[model samples]
Target: MTLTIEELRAGVPKHSRKMITQNVVEVLNQLSSDHGEDFAEHYKQNLMSMSTVLKSGTYNMKDYMNAVKFSAFRLMDHSDVDSYMLAFPERYQRLMLKYADYGDEQSIRADKISSFVTAYKKNEIVAKVTEQALIPSRILNAPMFQTALNIQMSIAMSSRSDQVRSQAAESVMKYTMSPEVQKIELEVGVKGQDEIMALRTEMHRLASQQQGTIMSGTNTSLEIAEQVILHEIEDHDDIDISGELG
Candidate 1:
């Protein structure tokens, strides 16, 4: 049976889900284009099975590579193997010699087949497939995320209870609205008498500077009043004037 991308993504961790799912989809598309749809379908099934095992977090990279290699081998026909060996005779001969230590003919043949499959995985196309198969899927997609907002909208439009409808509408609005940018205000206070006195002296100097500007008609009375009030608020112990205006 064919597994959807959504189903495949269910087995993946949230952090890597999107990246892995996208890569898997691309690899599957490439497979379908290179081979037939039937071959790609079988490969996808194998990938799904591997993904299921992956959810347990028990499988290692070697197990994953072997799984993909065997999956491709299972789909290979005699003609396919013959074509591969013809294409890479030296590699196949090397693999056969590598497995010659096995005692019986059947044992040697089985070992040769296993080694051949492993070596086959190094081919460019097969390497791409194996790399993608190792990654898990995504947890959420755009459609699924939008579903919650859609439900809220429906409730807001058609609910029987007016209060419930209002609440739902408010919720929908809350979700749809762009978040307000928060403004942070930090206030540093002077608790020591020495620090307070130093601040008072600075405020007096600033006020004197402003007085000359006021006399010269460069500064307004209201501006001077605001500056004095701000300084007074800073000097006071019980008052807090550090916050956003709105």
Candidate 2:
């Protein structure tokens, strides 16, 4: 049985995803050569929007044709991005820059750990971090410390968060994100407990539902591949347009 990240990952085996990605790229370039660079770029960009890989967020297989998946996969296996960078820097420049930006963002996140800093002052970072956390905890006034933790999870390097914060985030994620876990809120009186429990359940359920709804909109990378490949074959007929194009 293949370890699954999400539903769309079912058809493709885990190991071959990269080779498929490289094939996709090769086909993309070939299409470009056959058609015109203009057509190629438009085709690639359309696929890219489908492949949309965000620099922030927990590494999940959400987007289509996202090279970031390969980048993350490569890093997890080798614990380094150097080989990936050197092997196909131009082809995977987005992932390279993304990995690089992760480091840069980590530095920024680490520096803003001070209590004096406000999430409002750093809105972009805070927003990205919150989205990455995948926790829709309501905050009438989100304090710096909480948002700081969110930021750490969003873009910080694995080592950036000390053991305590790491454990806290892990615990939160483990309980909050798990389907088996009861998301009841702890309260004092029986009435309060019941109300809070109901509310927490609703919120947690809604968050999960919202997440599922979002994921459903995602088109598989192969969808893009099919459209591009078909356009290339039917429209260009493998004819070289490198001269007229460039």
Candidate 3:
């Protein structure tokens, strides 16, 4: 019910008004099943058609960018986008290979760290180094964690483009790619992977030392999902009760 074109504009990173309109329209439609057509209609475009805007070249950079908080690190600098867009090739086939090879290692480290912390919390793994209730904050403050975070920022920034980000993806691809930049990207990715791996190894050592109720990483993730489901159910229940009382 809170959804609206204006709300989406303020919530999402500031961009072209036409783009915000288009993105919000898509978001509301996607949730039409659970939220109802009326809810989706609240943000639906009218008067000026989306097709007209698209033809005019008004575009949104983050059509796939959801505002919902997920278990992933996101970098958000459009101005420095030139640094990241240069990292990807114009062709989808080439893009996949580059990602597979130079994929951000921080994403991997983030998964490991998140699982380790979840287990630590539900299982109450105590750190011998601190001799106190294991604080995830302590681990987060670890030097490696900060470095991993920085690496992800670099990857995110490198994936965006400033020149034609406002234009559609096709328009951006028309520009020429730099060979020297790709060489530098490869060198940077190699060094980053090495550092990321070392940091991950240290974190694994941290996890091994701790005693917990949930030792397995797989089980830890399942537990987290269960917790999310319960929270959502509670929210829906509250909404129903509120409506009934009204």
User: Which has the greatest TM-score?
Assistant: 1
How far in Å is the alpha carbon of 187 misplaced in model 2? 28
Deviation in Å, model 3, residue 84 alpha carbon = 24
Runs of candidate 2 exceeding 4 Å displacement: 1-66, 69-72, 86-174, 177-196, 199-246
TM per candidate comes to: 0.28, 0.19, 0.18
Best by lDDT: 1
Q: Write the per-residue lDDT of candidate 1 for residues 1-246, one digit (tens) a residue.
A: 334567656645454345455556665666676666876776656654444344434554345434553545444643434434533457667766776776654575455554565566575445544444433221123234345654665554445554554466566556556535312222424246465445435534553565577679986756544442333223233322232110
- Candidate 1 segments exceeding 4 Å error: 1-21, 58-66, 75-246
Q: How well is each residue in 1-246 modelled by candidate 3, as lDDT tens digits?
A: 435666555444333444666555565656566446653442232111111222323343332222110111111222212212221213323434445544454553243333433343242111111121122333334445444444433322232332121122222223212333211111121334545444434333323332132344444533422322111111111111010000
* Per-candidate local distance difference test: 0.49, 0.35, 0.31
Poorest 10 consecutive residues by lDDT, candidate 3: 237-246
Error of 2 at 240 (Å): 52
Stretches of candidate 3 above 4 Å error? 32-63, 66-246
lDDT of 2 by residue, 1-246 (tens): 111223222334444344344445565566455546764554443333222123333333323333432232233353223323332346445543445644664453344322112322244433332232222222222244334433433321123223333344354345445444322222222324454344434434433443444458654433322222111111112221111000
User: Deviation in angstroms for 182 in model 3?
Assistant: 23
Q: Can you give the lDDT of residue 200 in candidate 1?
A: 38
Residue pairs with colliding backbones in model 3 are 84-158, 84-159
The residue pairs found clashing in candidate 2 are none
